[model samples]
Target: MTTTLIIGGSSGIGLATARLLVARGDEVHIAGRSAQRLDDARLALGDAGTDVATHVVDALDAAAVASLAAKRAPVGRLVLTLSGSEGAGRLAELDLAALRRAFDGKFWAHLTVLHAALPHLAENASITLLGAITARASMPGTAGLAAVNAAVEALVAPLAAELAPVRVNGVSPGYVDTPWWGMVPDADRRAFFDGVASELPTRRIATADDVAEVVALVATNPNLTGTVIEADGGARLKAA
Candidate 1:
């Protein structure tokens, strides 16, 4: 059975991806910072009698992240869905400290996990990093978000080359409706989604499952390395 490790798999796109992979019969191991969330995820996955493991580890902790990867050595597939939105704002008004935290939490965290998992990666392992549409599209109030996600997308091509044989790709989604938006009240969130859907060509915001399909594609497709797939519901086109 393929052993897959997913970082930040407690909620949102990460957890959604784990569900898909678990359903596909992969031995999935998910990690997150919250023990309670991890337990909940494990139970959810286990209820279906799927093979799933949960680990509690913060993305920012280098040693713990490395240890998790080390323990899950020979991982056949690795998915990174860790990120932060604390840096979302106009450049002039952006909190520099928050921006730094965003980078540390998302960009650097991605790299740290990748570096830690490098040695343990299976010979033909696949690495899928979750980026965002803001990286390539012109989106106001998302300069910091773009910077962080752009950095991740920038690594895809070069890393695919460097990691040769081991495919490295990215999935960049636009305005996905995930727990990341829990801060917004349910009614307001719906209104926001409605507004965004009206503006988007697809007429709807993507769900975590929608993005997970793309992640699963990149994870399983043998000939799709060095590419960043966009599952933005045409938001990129609209932004363009």
Candidate 2:
């Protein structure tokens, strides 16, 4: 069974992918910032048996991440899906703190994981980073997200090359239905998704399962690296 380490596995795409991996008989070690959430995930995935382990980690905490990485044996697959939210205002009115917060959480935290875990990554192992469709198709109030996501994509490319023999790739998901959407106000969430769904060629937003499957593929495909799989239900096409 493949041994995988998943950072930010408490919820959303990360949690979904952890469940999928466990179900497939892979040994999964999940980490997140919430002890309660990790415990809840461990309980929920109990049916997958003892192959699942959860750790409490703040990806932004370099020392904490290094400590967690040290606790595990060499890992065959490393998936980082750390998430953060930022400004809701126009670029001209953007909140600098919000921008920095988002960048630090999503982009820098991802880097921290790689820096700390690189030595522990097994040869031929795969690394997957999460990006958003907003990075490619811009929208109002998403300037910070776009910038950070693009940086993630760019960051992974060279790393993929540098880490060769150990593959690195990214998954840029569209509007996957997850708790991250909970960040938006309830009244606007449905309408916002509806509008996004209407514009996609599939006429529906992506499910966590859709993105999870892509993540799985990236993790297992040794031949694939430095590529961003756009699992967005053709949202990119619709955007054109």
Candidate 3:
């Protein structure tokens, strides 16, 4: 059985991807900062009757990530879906702390995971990172996220080359129907999605599974590396 480690596999795209992998008979190890959320995810997986392990980890903590990696055997794939800040502010007005936290969580945390997991990643294994469409199609109030995500994509290219036999890629997803919408008011959220969905060439926002399928594809494709598969439903072109 293929052993895969999913960092930040508690909710949103991470949880959805975990469910898909478990269903496909992969031995999945999930790591998240919240013990309660991890327990809930295990329950939601509903006794998949497969080998599933949960570890409490804060991806920002390099030592903690290193410790967790030391405990695990070599893995066939590693997926990093850590969340970043959603701070809504102009560049001049943005909170430096919030911006720093965003980069720490998503950018630096991913690097830490790679550092710790490199030894445990088998040859020809895959490493998938999550990015956002905003990285390419920037918008107001999301400057920090766009900047960091763009940097992450840039980082992937060199890492993919350095990793050589191991495939390193990323999935840049557009708006998806996830709990993130809860951050906005109900009416505003509805209006926002309605507009976003219509603007996309596919006439819809992406789903968690949609993104996961791309990740799975990348994981299994031996020849693919330094690729950023956009699961954005043509949202980028529409935005452009």
- Highest-TM-score candidate: 1
Q: Name the regions of candidate 3 deviating beyond 4 angstroms.
A: none
* Candidate 2 Cα deviation (angstroms), residue 174: 1.1
lDDT score at residue 29, model 3, on the 0-100 scale: 90
Q: Taking the tens digit of each residue's C-alpha lDDT, what string does model 2 give over 213-236?
A: 999999887689889989988876
Cα lDDT, model 1, residue 8: 91
TM-score of each: 0.96, 0.94, 0.93
Model 3 worst lDDT run, 10 consecutive residues: 43-52
Q: What is the lDDT of residue 156 in candidate 2?
A: 74
- Model 3 C-alpha lDDT per residue in residues 1-240, reported as the tens digit of each score: 878899988878888888888888788899999999888878877876245789999887878877777676678889998876454478888987888878887888888888988887878789999988889975667788888788777777899999889899999998988776777888998899998888789998788888888888887788889999889998778767
At residue 63, candidate 2 shows an lDDT of 85
TM-score computed on alpha carbons, candidate 2: 0.94
Best by lDDT: 1
Question: Over all chains combined, what TM-score does candidate 1 have?
Answer: 0.96
Question: Between prediction 1 and prediction 2, which has the larger lDDT?
Answer: 1
